[model samples]
Target: MDTVKIRNKDMLWDIAADLHFPPGFDSKKKHPAIISVHPIGSCKEQTSGNVYGEALAKAGFVVLVFDASFQGASGGEPRFIEDPAQRVEDIRRVTDYLVTLPYVDEARIGTIGVCGGGTYAINAAMTERRIKAVVSITGVNFGRLSREAFSGYNPLGALEAMAQQRTSEARGGEVRVDNYLPCSVEAGRKAGLTDIDVLEATDYYRSPRGEKPHGATSGLFSHRAAAIGWDAFYLAEVLLTQPLLVVIGDKPGGFGAYRDGQEIYGRAASKQKELVVVEGASHYDLYDKPEPVAEALEKVVPFFTKHL
Candidate 1:
């Protein structure tokens, strides 16, 4: 568990990461590596990014769990912004750093993304062939998820608001940010957010389960402007050529919960792609729960071993 700083090729943000090495790791020998990416509005310390990084390290792969630039310990301005282009580039840049290491097998690298990170991972793999395998746990495309979740009800209205907000900001208004989840369980229930996924997300992110002070609860309005119009599913139909594994939950009554993973798995052009729905588990269950996390790693660890 060593903390390291990686500078992006653009020389703008200094990405902060935690590098994990397998027990008795020898720097003299090259080993396969996994780059673990965190979800939107979150950092390296809050979710399954670091957890899977540790698990894969123990499974004998070198792993890096890094905070995306501008989100965590990494350096960037106007904090909590989610720039899709920058995020994808961040993964490629991380891979660039990995290949520079003498102990890393540049030809055998993989990536695991949780939540929105999954979409970024897919996008990165599409253009950067350095990533040999792709694994996503309970993943979702943040752009599509946000748009569809609010469609028909408030999609048009929200778009109008964002446009107005951007215009105001350009004319010199105070910067405004909004939370994607309620600040607490009680707040969520009060706001009529009854879906178990939302409730569990609020509990996990806002509560002691996964909260970190440097990590933010809300995303910037500026960030939303960039994300709202983006679609991660773009170009996935043709350029995504790596072996892909998507692990999503299929709880008894959780119908729309796993649709994003299904869509991603469907669009991928990979000859070897699979969707493993974990029975009785909800989307948020895979974030931190031991049983589901273990089950997820059971599939992912081997996928990398076999492919990378």
Candidate 2:
């Protein structure tokens, strides 16, 4: 794996990514490529980005695992901003970078995203025809998830808080940010996040399991405005025309379940689409566990090979 810098087309940010070449690859030959996008608050090294990238590379496809534009090693100000629109643009920009390589097959490019990155990938596919195929693992339609899943998800209250924060910022008040995941295992448990998803997220992002210097699972509080207004399922019936493969855990309840998969599958206008729910796996299990990650890769590798 080699680290490389990709500049967003807007010339606004430099995306840091890990490029994995297929075993015995020939630089003179063009190869199909896959872009593996990490989850929200995740970097190129965390989640299953590297897992999938390495696996696909071994299968003879070039893979690029990257951090989002504003987070991780990517350059951006008002750090940790998780704007969905910009995230979608970031995926396209990465695709832009991929096509520039002489050894990359421009017509056979595909993409995969995990967690919130999954949603961003879907949104990117809506108009980015360069993405011939799309795959989402444990996908979260963050806009919908924020409003529907959590019991205490209050849009009005969040908007009110965002308004207050905006006013305070205008007055030169101190910048305030919030962690996307629990600060610690104890904090997650104390906040009634004993569920598998929360526990695993806390462990993966906060603990040594998958922590990175820039991946603190935190973002600007004002990001609430973008989070609250963004919709991942903006035009599924029309623009989401690419073949889609939604992979998730089978466990009931949570964004990684079959229900969320069905929601995306139902809305997509793709004539060819599939949903694979890994048996007995929970939302976060597919993030890193060997069994679940392997299970997802089993489906993903073939899907892209066939489509792209």
Candidate 3:
């Protein structure tokens, strides 16, 4: 594995990434490649690089795991803004970088995204034809999640609040940011958040199990309006024609990854698509648990192997 910087042309910032080569890799021969995108509020070193990237590389593909622009080790000002459009473009930009490598087969390039990253990957593959295959693991359509959050009340009111905060920031108010999860599972329980996904996410991201200095799980509060207004599966019925794999846990949660996977499976225009529900698994369980992760990869590896 090699740490690398991918150039983001539109933002003029470098996307920090890790490039993993398969065992006995030969640069003289072109090999299929994959771009592993991290979850929102997470970095490459967590699931994208640490789990999927490493596993896929060992399975005989060149995998690149990257930090989205403005988060993690990537470069951007007004940090921690989770713009869905920019996140989609970041996948395309990573593809642009991958195709430049002599050892990469551009035609065989694929992508796998986890959590919010899965949604962005689906969004990106809609227009980015260079990506021949897509795998979305526990993908959450963030727009739907945001609008439905807090019991589906006052989405417009939340947008209005974001507008006010953005205006204040433009006028020199301090930029407001916050973590994506509670400090810990115990804290979340104390706060009355008993959702399995929420608690497991807190355990995975906020604990030593999956924690990294770059995986700060922070986001700009004002910029959330962008996500609330955007839909990751928009036009997927017409535009998403590539071979796709949607994986989700059986247990549903407030975050709605399971629903998103079901909707995408039904809506996508892909001639070849499959949805696998990992039994007894919740959203966060697919992120890192041994059995679930292995189960997911068993399907993912062959899907990409055949499609790419």
Name the candidate that leads on lDDT: 3
Candidate 3 vs. true structure, TM-score: 0.98
Model 3 residue 270 CA deviation (Å) reads: 0.5
lDDT, candidate 2, 256-275, per-residue tens? 44566778999999999998
Report the C-alpha lDDT of model 1 over 1-308, residue by residue, as the tens digit.
78899995576878998889999999999999999988877888766455787888999999988888778889888787888888888898889899998999999999989888887888889999999999988877766765666333466677788788878888998888877788799998998878787788788888888888766857777556566678877989999989999998886222243887888899999999989888778877888888888888889888999998
Q: Candidate 3 — which residues are off by over 4 angstroms?
A: 8-10, 150-152
Which pairs in model 3 have colliding backbones? none
TM-score for each prediction? 0.94, 0.94, 0.98
Candidate 1 overall lDDT versus native: 0.82
Name the better of 1 and 3 by TM-score: 3
Off by over 4 Å in 1: 150-153, 252-257
Q: What does candidate 3's lDDT look like per residue over 99-186, in tens digits? A: 8899999999999999999999999999999999999999998788878873256789988888998999999998999777899899
> What is the total number of backbone clashes in candidate 1?
0
